[model samples]
Structures are given as C-alpha cells and as structure tokens.
Target: MDVSLGTVFVSEIMGTAMLLLLGGGVVANVILPKTKGFNSGWIVITFGWGLGVFAGVYAAYKSGAHLNFAVTIGLLANGAAEYAPGVAVTFASTMVYLAGEMVGAFLGAILVFLAYKKHFDEDADPGTKLAVFSTGPAVRNYGWNFVTEVIGTFVLVFIIIAFGKTPSGLGPLAVALLVVGIGLSLGGPTGYAINPNRDLGPRIAHALLPIKGKGSSDWGYAWVPVLGPIVGGAIAGLVATAYVV
Candidate 1:
C-alpha cells in the first residue's frame, strides 16, 4: 500500500486545499457583509472549522492525513520513521510534505475568495475581510498570543498522538471534535490558529488577491502563528513520545 512521493504531494495538496476552502468559507459566510450566515457568532465558526478538518482528513488519507504541519512536525519530533504506512520519513519527504501543504493552503484561500466573491467585494472593514482569510488576535498581544497558540497546538498534537494509542475507532472525527473544543475554549484570544498553514497560507492569499479594501495582511503578527505552532508541535511530539504515547 505504499504510495509514491507524487501521490503524497498531490494528496496533501488536495486535502489541505479542501481544508482551507471549507474553513475560510465559513468565516466568510459569518463575517462578510450581506451573507446569510453573517454575524452568526463564534459557535458557528468553530463547527465550520471542525467540519473542515473532518473533510480534509478524508481527502488526505493517502498521506495519513497530516494536513496540518504541526501534526507532521510533531510526528517527526517524536522520532518516528514514516509519514504514512509506506512513506519513509526523510529530509526530502519532509520538504515535500511542507511544500504540498503550503501550495494547497494557498490555493484553498483562493477558492474561498472565489466562493465569496460578492461578499469580498462588499463594503466591510478591511480587517473583517482579512479575518475571513486568516486569524488575528482579539487583543493583539504578541507574547500572550504566541503562548495561546503554543498551548493550543500542544494539546492538539499531544492528543493526536495519544489518539493513536487508544482503541476507539472514531479516527478523523475525533480529531475534528478536538478542534471544535479547542476553538470554543482556546480560540477567544488568538482565534486558535494552531496550524501554521491554516493561518500563513491564507494570509498570503489575502495579501496577493485583488479584493476591494482588503487592507493590510497583518504581517506584524504573522510570526506568532507560524513559530508558535512549530514550537508547540515539536514539544508535543517529544512529550507524547516520552510519556503520553
């Protein structure tokens, strides 16, 4: 059942693309002006992202659904060998996964914008429009924001690794629910962007796209999501390997 590197790449591309598509689509639906789901509240947004994870996992099953780089990095930090059943972990393979995920995430944001074209065109706060594509702090404290992301991502990767040990058969659904819980509990401060690709890729799209009044991409806060998740995921991998798993 070993898949080629091309399969892994394409699988991740499709999966991550599907992820951001649904995830971003939800934010756009809720926050964009004149949309049916506009101002629908936080509960709707959390569930939307959860469902996105569910769908993305199935789409990327071929690559063991490491749709989030945090998961991938966590696994590597845990000292595992293969990314999937047949894909051996190597420098090239790691790079390929990262590349595929970045490409897929960027493409996914484009798809979300296209889906919500009229809304993106509507008169909305530039920050609101940006929020549709990426996460930002509700409070804008860099140090605390990074801590929030790290803690959330730690729970994510730690539980994910632990899930492998449990005999329950929920699979991706469980991960989806975990994300929902995280969003509800930990999302208030930083919107729970525990995945770097989930934030950075779409933020890049926000910057490049021709949306009306899309505003600044918030590059100043960008490092938090990226670096925090990486550090969190790496720590989770090590901790899980040491005790939890």
Candidate 2:
C-alpha cells in the first residue's frame, strides 16, 4: 500500500512498455506486409489492445496500474485515497507515472519497429505505417474526431470506475474487456485513441525513427486525441466521484 515514487515509476514504465509493445505490435502485424497477421482486421486489433491492457495492469498492479495518463488523472480526480492507501497521489507521483508512460510508450514503439523492421521496409503506405504508432480519423474531421475521442474515453474511464465498485475484483481482465467493448462499439471514427500517452508517445517514436517511406506524423490532428481524452477523463472522474459518493 505504501509505495515509493521510484517503485511507482518503475512499475508503470514496465507495464506501459508492455502495453504499447503488444498494442503497437498488433497494428504492425495487421498493416505490415509479409507479416503473419497481415490484414487480420479490426477485431484482432481490439483483442490485442485488450490483452495489452490486461498484461499492463497485472504488471503494474502494485502501482494501481494507472498505465494511461488519462486514467491517472481520472483516478486522482475520483479520489485516490479510496483506492490507493498510503500512496500519496501528489504532483511528484503524478509526474512519475506520466514520465514512465511516455518513455515506456516510446520504447514500445521502437520495439515494434525492430520486430517488424523488414516488413516496414516492404510496406509502401505511410498511412499504414503511421497507424501502427498512432491513430488517425477515418474521415479526417477534427470536430467529429474530438467528439468521438471524448465519447470513447468517457466510456472507458466511466466503465473502469464502475468496475472498481464491484466486489468481485475482476481486476485487469474486466478493464481489458471494457477496452474491447469500447473499441468494438466506438472505435470506428478515430481508431479509439482513449489514452493520450498511447497516441503521443508512439507518434513521437514514429517521427524520430528512420523508417523508409514513412509519411507525415499528422501533427495537425494530434491535439484532438490528446485534449479530448483529457476532457472526457476529467468529466468521467468528476461524474464518478459525485455518483459514488
């Protein structure tokens, strides 16, 4: 219960690294030519991401598994005292989690690229390459894209809070299933980038990495996923706090 900030940072880094590794790996598998899982469809991606959450949560359970920055913000807003005993959720600890997540996300993207380096060279579409790292809107509409991210992330954090109330303590599995459900239902428009770090970190990696034929990072539409999730997560936290209390 009484965890040090160092412990929290290490745990989150390891957990989030795994989260992005598997999550990004799935996209690479689907989009990259010559890969075994190429063209596996959206269902594979949703399941892969769900499983990534499961693994990351288990890996970071000691740190409350706040793998996503949005989740961290939501949990704190909802009252960390209720869930994390003796673990002071201060500004410093928040920074630890954020730093860990960002670094882990970037590392994970690098690992994915390494794993599929040959396929990346074989693949010609920059959009497909970029999709492995970050998200893009199907129709490229910023207004609607922001709305979709808000709704999707609201469902994610809201349902996660609901799961916390259950006595069964379904833990990571429940959250993983929640992610899958969100993806299946609401992922169409913006690829369901419910986590800001999940998008930004890998996007940064894609930009930094020297992948041949890779296209623009699409910085113009990046703010929607980041800002929308923050807003949605904050709203969910406020709503959950009020409803629960």
Candidate 3:
C-alpha cells in the first residue's frame, strides 16, 4: 500500500476534483431552473453524492482513495499507533493531500458552474444558487448545526475505518452506500457535509465565481462544516486507534 507523495498529490487532486464536480453538479441540477433534474428532491441528491464518492474513490484508489481531507486526517491520527502502518501518512503527505483536495474542490465547483452556466443565469434565487456550492443549516442554529455535522462525519469516518477490514473491491461501493445513508438519514440538519474540503472549497468558489444573482456566501456559518468534521474525524480516529489498533 506504499505510494509516493507525488502520486498521492496527483491522485487526490484529480479524484477530489471529480468528487466536487459531480456532487456539486447534482445540487446545481436540482436547484437551478432550466435543468433537466430541477426540483428532483433530496433522494436524487443523496444518490448523486454517493455515486460521486464511488467515481472519486475508483480514480484515486492507488493513493488509498483519500479524496476527503477529514478521511486523510482520520487515517493520520489512526496511524499514530499501528492502525495504518507503512502507509506514508507523514506531515508532508498530509499537507499535500490537503492542498490537492482544496484545489480540486475549487476547480470542481468551477466546472459545475460552467456546465450549468445557462441555468445560473435563468435562476433568480440567490439561496438556491449558493446551495449548489455549499451546505447550509435547515434550521440556522449554529450549535445544533455543528452537532449534526459532527455526528454525520463521525458516522462517515468511523464506518470508513470499519469498512477497511472488508474485501478491497467492496471498499468503494460500501463507502458510497455509507455516504448515501448519511445523507438520507442525518443530512436533513446540515446537508451532511461530512468532509471539510467538500464544503469549504466550493463555498470559496461560490464567493469568487461571477454567477448572476448569487447571494452571500454565508461566511458566518462556514466554520461549522469545516471544524465539526475535523473534530469528528479526529474523534473517530482516536476511538478507532484505541479499539482496533
């Protein structure tokens, strides 16, 4: 399972870019007017994200398919002991993973916006447009929103670690299903960001993009998605190390 840092960077960048492209693309499709999948609802969104994870993981499996920064952090924390020995989870590699994921996520959001350029112009709702790029709380309560994100991301990273014991081929599918389940069951509160890169990168893109009628990037609520998932992933990693390693 040894891979060079260069491979990790390239794979993470490519895979995470694809992940955001498809995942954000789905939100754009359902929310933006003139799109074929307009108003297709949450089920479609959950499936889209799951499929996005599937595609991203398949493309990045050579570097352990860590398209998510939270996942990479979780594995690094786990590797502190013996849970993931000889896996090259060094500080330098972690930085590379983080850098790649951030860039990829930003680029992916840009791709989605370009692909749906016509819809952005036609759509008049700023909230809906922003939704395509980032997650927002259904209730707008920061404390509760943070809790929901923590619980959702804990389930995500913990289950991913648990699934590592399964057959190699089943890993991608299993994790995808886990994402779908998280979205369906726990996503109602905060749209199930579950990964810091997935939310922040696109939110940054939303801020920078020149989409017509795009509203505030909601920078006020942005920290929850990023910090909650990292805290949750760290907790999952520590628990997994204590229990499994």
Which candidate gets the maximum lDDT versus the true structure? 1
Clashing pairs in 2: none
Estimated TM-score for each candidate: 0.97, 0.95, 0.94
Misplaced by over 4 Å in model 2 are 165-170
Model 1 misplaced stretches (Cα beyond 4 Å): 165-170
Candidate 3: regions farther than 4 A off: 80-87, 165-170
The TM-score leader among the candidates is: 1
TM-score of 2: 0.95
Worst lDDT window (10 residues) for model 2?
Answer: 161-170
In model 3, state the lDDT of residue 76: 69
When 2 and 3 are scored with lDDT, the better candidate is 2
Per-residue lDDT of candidate 3, residues 1-245 (tens digit): 65667776787788888899999999988889988998899999999999999888887776677777788777767664322224455677778889888988999999999999999999468998999999999999999999998899888887777658321234888888989999999999999999999999999999999999988999999999999999888888778887874
Across 107-158, the per-residue lDDT of candidate 1 in tens digits comes to 9999999999988888999999999888999998999999999999999888
lDDT (Cα, 0-100) at 20 in candidate 1: 96
lDDT: worst 10-residue window of model 1: 161-170
